[model samples]
Target: MGSWERPYWESTVDSGVPRAAQRSGAYRRYLPDAIDGMALAIDGDLSRDVAVVERKLRALNGPGAEGLAGIARFLLRSEAIASSRIEGIAPSAQQVAIAELGQSESVRGVSEQAQLVANNMTIVREATTELVVADKVAVEDIVELHRSLLPNEPRHHELRTVQNWIGTSDWSPIDAAYVPPDPDRVVGLMTDLLRYLNGAAHAPLVQAAIVHAQFETIHPFTDGNGRVGRALIHTVLARRGLTEQAVLPVSLVLATLTDEYITGLDSYRHDAAPGSPPAGMAINAWLRTFVTAAEIAVEQSQQLVSAIEELRERWTERLAEYRMAAGLRAAPRADSAVARVLVHLPEAPVLTATTLARILDVSYPAASAALDELRQAGVLATKSIERGTTAFIAREVLDLVTWSERALASTRFDTRRAEPVRPVPARPQR
Candidate 1:
């Protein structure tokens, strides 16, 4: 292992029997030259391998891109759900949260975190749309994008604060690890990194890898660093217009490859030589691993999208057997309406007639009747309720929809000839 001078943050922690043993003596030197080279690799023209991947992605158009897009939406939705739940909000309440977010002309609420995520999704969509035609994007725009994602979250917004890292030392049981550079250094480091991100000397994917690693190493935020860091990947990719719709679920990939994900960051912190200079080899290894993960993520997402489309077709065929009112059919397509409602039920399984009426945009009687039909079909079950409020629960529809979407997105396809979905034939006006 390479040794280097310990950062001041590492020196300030108490070293008594209580905390001394927890400190890690392992320090890795970061070479600025390595960072520059890595930055070049990130901004450089697309490599043959990346171009091949891009062509493959483009060929995998239409259902393929749609599938990937669906997966991206779902994964992001899931992340928001998980993060909100972690912050003490119940999953079922997400509807209210989302509804409030959607209806409010202005973004303002106690659910600031959730709103930030929603905004991030919007920015990501816009950036992805623009990327399809652009060759490169400004790094300042990325910083602004990050700012937009968390403008209200104090510790996470645009500033870095003093914080302690945790690790285990040989003699110390467990203690604070290295203290990062002061705010000035952190900003300078990030500026350099962003310059690398915006430059044209490296592949976008490679840049994503190096930048992600460097951002984490910088530990720029006092909290929410991980989440924001992950968001940066989507920002860069979307800005670069790499994927169709910026549909990659990098977090999903990172979440699954938790071991390597953590190790990659650890390797950067523990393996590189101290004070010698940044080593391109160490960063490159991490980039290659990230690219591999991304490729896998894309394949998996494509498959998931294909599976979802197939399942949706099957569901449509099944639904066709019933001569339901056109108005009912007009209720937002199942995935957009019913599936969204059902996913929240793991926490609050009981949906009252009033709530159903609002959610489905039908009269209370109509909503209640629809519930009865669903219940009779064994797709929903009833639970105890008070007053005139009837509570109904969705069955396995949520799982079916979610998993099918994943399967379709993971399947690969030909991008060049693939076209966007043609407009559906219009039904006769009543």
Candidate 2:
């Protein structure tokens, strides 16, 4: 079957047009068991639910009111991943450019794709935040998110004024309901899903799973359905207060199991028979997969966080031993700010001195001094000029950030590495 064909669903349309039909796929036969288990789990007492899942998350927290501390920790780390590429970082650099859209704080190199990523992140962040408060996440909200994600790209975010479909030839199945829905159908399905989502009784995980599956099946919006759909998962969980902080990095999990992730969706699209169950069973299986992934991601993230904190502490001890300058003590602080700026350097390696001043919260000269120090330290290099002004680039810092990011990416899947701990010697007091 082609990319358009749902795995288990038989194609009814000979014309190469996608159309939905009653699912007779193998997935339909087994969905009931999955759904029943999920419903039972969700309907159980809040305490039990917390015991099963929240306990794993709780271990990541230090103390009181650290609500959903797992998710919060995940969000910060994920943001690091999202913002890394703008600084000319690797791997995520491409994904970041495709996802985030905003100005960098430091003067650094950035590419067109990095700009795209910065824009995407801004849109995702705003939309997800709004979703946390709103009862129903509307198509309009999604449109707004898309607009934010691709501000300059008109075709990407614009609503479909004309009909669109996924299929190839004269045999397009108009009667089959399994194919991706048309634009009008897409809007209707999303509206219905949102209504279901806003209801009081629906379990958050179940609701999230349903919405994600339906959105994928609907394939609404010309582009970014996948990213937006994924974003919706976080929105629902956050809105329900399942995560005290943005601890769940679902994308990292999904990105890791790329093939199985797609196959799960494919199974749903094909096996969901009309007038049967709500595809809840197939969807629940997907959720189970997701839950497992989430558990693994949380564990990995906790390790990473511990590693970073430990690394920082070791560096602190080392700095004391080496008698490093106070300025060097501030270098780690620059990691976040400098990393943000460098991720944007793929498109253009220029930021106005005034902008740098605002970002670094220092005077132009101070910002310039920081740039000069970095340049002298071989961490950054000077790029081109605009109107007799200079722009700087962070080559080594970007490399370091990218190297660190690989650790995050490595944890995206099932592969686990022992957390690297730096060995620091005892410092002799003067």
Candidate 3:
């Protein structure tokens, strides 16, 4: 049965700590049931719904899709950014791209929030890719993932030694809306969680929902729990082979369904007997919510794929027009730098010539010429990164990224009728 224990909090009166936090008292800490062997009773209708969404996700990652790999990269970034935004680390997609550009070369005009989101993007990519290939996901593996997510925050790199709570007093767990297990219980719970993750006892979507909810319940790390928990959703999908090329961006939909999302998690944390009908219903309700979010993710991501493909077609026509006006007799060879750069623009929308040369394995002059050609053709725009170092951006790609973010932010998936519940960056200026 899910249970709770009253742990006495003898608060230390640290400087600047609130006086209320100094009062010593007993607070309840939840101890969630180990789920490695838990039986989940899902109805047939819900089972079929989950299976249909799984098929859609697979089709989205289907082999031979043009620009599949690049689109996957873009979606991965979108997922990371949305996940970070859910934690209130909102940053413009373009700013995040520039922050990513900063990783390759000197850059300016990027914020710390953008860089943090960029770090999230990197860790999400690494987690989904690396965790899928590991023989077994160890406790250390999950710890390392947290470490990577918070490279600058040393205290958060390890499992939290002190108590942490969500909402209410920042100084103490007093009156907090939710409190996870005691610090001493963390490793054992995490071990059980990892064991479940390494197995395939449930359907992909069901398993992902349980894994994510369990991780959030454990709240293992003092910080970054939300981002790490969301990354695990993608990891579970990839490991189960449901997603091989594209991330579902489920967090994007979840962010818009914040109230339902929290309520679902709350239901999952019920004190009912783990084997009782109430327990089954509790989890099943959460599964329905998660499955719905997954369905929305697939539908919206499909639209993004279509939008990107359409943009690619427009670039091709514009390139043709530019070449015709220049009086060139034939198109640039398929393997030429211009062609290669165009192929990769979806993935790497912002680039420096130096970065492009390294990415495409071409001569510096060749990459520079390709950038010049694409810029002249109106397929790319130039932005000053730093003195003497200009970064080229595919504004349309960045705008699409912004639009996707905004679209996901809205409850309706259309910004025209609904404003975002969270702050979404305005569309980039042309």
Candidate 4:
């Protein structure tokens, strides 16, 4: 059974702190049950719900899905962005893209927040790839993920040795909304959590929900717990082969349902015995929220796939018009640099000639020519990113990316139908 313990909180800071923050008191810290060997009883209706969403997930990764290669690339960014947004790290999709470019090259006007979100993308990608391939995850793997998420913050890279709380004064755990198990219990709890992850006792979605909820409850790291917990969602799905090529972007749905998300986590933290009715109900409720988010993610992904395909078709028409106006006799060859660049636009919506060459495995001159040809066709816009480097922007693709962000923020998944529940990027200028 999981229960809370009343622990004495000793304040270590006093300068400029409020009296309440500087005072010592006893705080309730939750200690969750070890999930290893726990038998979960999911009823028939909820089982059916899980099956439906799993089917949808498999379909989204199906062979016939359009622009999946491109969708896979950008959807990773979307997932990272939404996950960060849930932590109040909001950055426009454009700013994030620029920060990504800034990672390797000089780009002016990138915000620190955007850079942090960009780092988050790397962490999310690593979670899906590295953790998925590991034969068995260790506690160190989770710590490494947190380290990657906060690369510059050396103090937070390891499991916290001191007490931490979710909401309240930062100086102490006094009157905190949620305090995790004491630091000494973190390593043991995490070991049990990984034991459950290494085994496949439940449905993929069910296991993912339990793993994520358990991780958040444990709150092992001093910082980046929410982001790491969300990333674990991907690790579970990918290791189970539910999402092979593309991310599910469930965080996009969760960001819209922030209140419900918190409530679900709270319910998962209930202090009932593991096999008791209240415990079953609490886990079931959290599973329903997760399943619904997965379903919505699949639906929104289909819409994005179709939208990207349509945009590609429009690009073809523009290229054809440009070719005719320039008196060119034949379309670009399928294996030509121009065609290859066009196909890769969604994956690399903004790229410099140097980077494009590396991405396409072509010569620098060839990549530059392909970019220039696309720019002439008005399929791409060129921006001077540095003193000598020029970047090609697939504005149409980025517009759709921005629109998808706005749509995800909206309750109806369509901005015109419902206003966004949270702030989103402004519409791209024509």
TM-score, one value per model: 0.60, 0.58, 0.87, 0.87
1 or 4, greater by TM-score: 4
Error of 2 at 149 (Å): 2.9
Ten residues in sequence with the least summed lDDT for candidate 3: 63-72
Give the residue spans of candidate 2 off by over 4 A: 1-51, 58-109, 156-178, 200-203, 243-247, 266-280, 322-430
Candidate 1 local accuracy as lDDT?
0.51
Residues 287-316 of candidate 1 have per-residue lDDT tens digits of 656876777766766666565556455444
TM-score between model 4 and native: 0.87
Candidate 4 local lDDT, 6-113, one digit each (tens): 888777777798888889888888998889988778878999989988988888776425365454455456445554544554676666777888877788877877
lDDT by residue (tens digit), candidate 3, 176-289: 889999889899999999999999899998999999999999999988898788889988998998877766779768978999999999888877544544777778888999
Go through the candidates in order and give the clash count of each. Answer: 52, 57, 0, 0
lDDT of 2 by residue, 76-177 (tens): 334433333234332243223222213543323455554544555555576678878886667688778666555555776756643334443234333333
What ranges in model 3 sit over 4 Å off? 6-26, 63-91, 106-120, 171-174, 273-277, 329-331, 386-389
Number of the top-ranking candidate, with lDDT as the measure: 3
Model 1 residue runs over 4 Å out of place are: 1-4, 8-52, 59-61, 81-157, 161-163, 166-182, 267-278, 323-397, 400-430
lDDT of each: 0.51, 0.49, 0.83, 0.81
